[model samples]
Target: MTQDKHSRRRMLAMVGGALAMPSVLRAQATDPTVVGGTAEARRNISSFRTQRWEDHFDSLGVATLLADTQSRALHYWSADGSDYRLYPTSVPMSEELTKRGYTKVVRKRVGPDWTPTQNMLARDPSLKYMPPGPDNPLGTHALYLDWPAYLIHGTHDTRKIGRRSSSGCIGLYNEKIAELYELAPVGTQVRLI
Candidate 1:
């Protein structure tokens, strides 16, 4: 009887240990480089928590963009309205997007230099302008909008995607934003809700 009790206890303990392994594995999975991931390219990628293509708007017309602050996702529609795709993005954690509704792309830049906004400088005066580079906060491309002090740009940091982590700018992954740069032109309609 004692032997049977011990065997059951051992089985239960092993099962419990197995159940606990996933959380441990997930934590380890997040940083492949730090976790000694040789093929750490996978960890460097960021994604959206949710994505779907339904009639998400009254009119995501040709050459239009819809940035959802709640989901931290960006959806772009083509000129002909044939192709619509979703991409993960990061938005301002603290910046109020009060000037919402309709806006348009005013200009665009490749490998854009990042100048700290007045608000940013207010928090840290020493943070001067950042030159364009792989490490530049505005990763590879940027689409400046008519909205003052706002931009849709790229980031070297993939960890911020699908999260509220930006100072007010909308950010995408390097690869994704590069693709968006090609698709979005100057004067494209952008709606932020």
Candidate 2:
């Protein structure tokens, strides 16, 4: 009798799962945002696929940084092609706030400060300047791009790393930015797409 009960319970569980499978498949197909199985998994997800530098740039001058906003990942290649690193990043909150196309790292700074841009201030009058520290939005390191007010910088907030959370910058975790800062010299070619 015990064996029969156990067998029946197993059969019921299988039937229930089979009934739920269609809804699960439909959800996965219809929703682009649905990934993995949990909220934590979705928020932390960044698709890190292997990328060839030649596909993006003519040459790895100094180094190269390709920030793919769609995938929420940053790809790096060394000038000599000896090193490559992929980092999950926070992209601009919206496409209107994003700046695309080619640029280069024009400057590098440790302990970078934060000052709201005119547009930022216009949107939020409460915004003010912030000196470099734990609270600074730019975190520990910053690689200023050739475009005015654009940067590939670090963020103290780890939750922002794999989300669309930045104002207009590509943001890495502080530790990751520190490593990139060491490897990516000023003049590293950068592209945002």
Worst 10 residues of 1 by lDDT: 41-50
TM-score of 2: 0.80
lDDT (Cα, tens digit) per residue for candidate 2, span 112-141: 999999989988999999999999999999
- TM for every model, in the order presented, reads 0.69, 0.80
The per-prediction CA RMSD against the true structure, in angstroms, equals 9.6, 6.7
Top lDDT prediction, candidate number: 2
- In candidate 1, how many Å is residue 72 off? 0.7
Candidate 1 residue lDDT tens string, 28-118? 4233242364433122224332322243445544478888786577988887778878888998887463345778899999989988888
Q: Which stretches of candidate 2 lie over 4 Å from their true place?
A: 1-12, 15-45
Can you list the residue pairs that collide in candidate 1?
Answer: none
